[model samples]
Each structure stands twice: as structure tokens, then as C-alpha cells.
Target: MTEPATRVIVVTVFVIGALTGCSRRDRGQREVIQNKGSDTLVNVAQAWAEKYKEVDPTVAVAVTGGGSGTGISALL
Candidate 1:
């Protein structure tokens, strides 16, 4: 094969490989699930967050414990 043909093939393969590895998921798009309340509930909230991350690696769940009032304020 000619040098130009070989170069074209190489470039094509590189482009295809790069695109195949690229994720269509928007990096900027994030799902935030906030859990707040008693410290006793913190463990359960963390567990849920971990499971969620397994399903949607991009999602971020923040768990804070300062009582229900604090949680509600944070939401606002």
C-alpha cells in the first residue's frame, strides 16, 4: 500500500478508537440527592449513596446530619 493510504488508515483507526472510548454521558450533568436528619440515619443515607453511585457513577449524594430543620434549611 502507498504511504498516503497507510497514513489515512492509521488516522481513521485512531479516531474511531478515541470516539469509542468517549462516554456520551454529559460530564457537567449531575444528580444531587441530599439526605439530612438524625445522625442515626446517616448510615442508611450513605449506603443509598453508594448504591446510587454504582448505578450512576456521575451522581453525587451529600448526606448531612444536623437534624431535620438543618436538612430543610440546606435544601432551601
Candidate 2:
């Protein structure tokens, strides 16, 4: 409703949509996108991941949350 809330939703949607294209696969392996971060975003992220699976059944989106610290560590 608020401008900032709308912005966050838009950005989150864009990032998730972008990530669908970034999934990596190995020989004979299925595609997976690991989305981890922000406890505040956990519910929304999980919902998106589920919906995305419906759109593209070939790829799996794994969403996890443990705050930004955990996400940063996972990234490195």
C-alpha cells in the first residue's frame, strides 16, 4: 500500500524472476535455485517458489531464511 512496501514487493518479485534464469545444472542433474536470506521475506519467498514451480516444473526453487547473516555466509 505504502510506496516503500510497494517498492520492496516489486524488487523482490524482480529478483525472484531474475533468479529463475540463473539456475545451474550439472550433467543429468535437475535445475535448482537456492534462495536464502531475510527472515522478513521468508513467507513471500516460499510462496513465490511454490508458484514458480507451477510455472516451470523443470526447476526447483529452495527458499530458506535465517537472517541476512546466514544468507551472506551461504553466498561466500
* Best-performing candidate as measured by lDDT: 2
Task: Please provide, for model 1 over 1-76, each residue's C-alpha lDDT reduced to its tens digit, 9 standing for 90 to 100.
Answer: 9999999999999999989958665778886777877677888888888998999887799888888788777768
Residue-level error in angstroms, candidate 1, position 36: 2.4
TM for candidate 2 is: 0.62
| lDDT by residue (tens digit), candidate 2, 1-76 | 9999999999999999999978666767778899998999999999999999999998999999999998999999
The estimated TM-scores of all candidates read: 0.53, 0.62
Candidate 2 local distance difference test against the native: 0.93
RMSD of each: 13.3, 12.0
**Where does candidate 2 clash, by residue pair?**
none
Give the distance in Å from residue 24's predicted Cα in candidate 2 to where it truly belongs.
Answer: 9.3
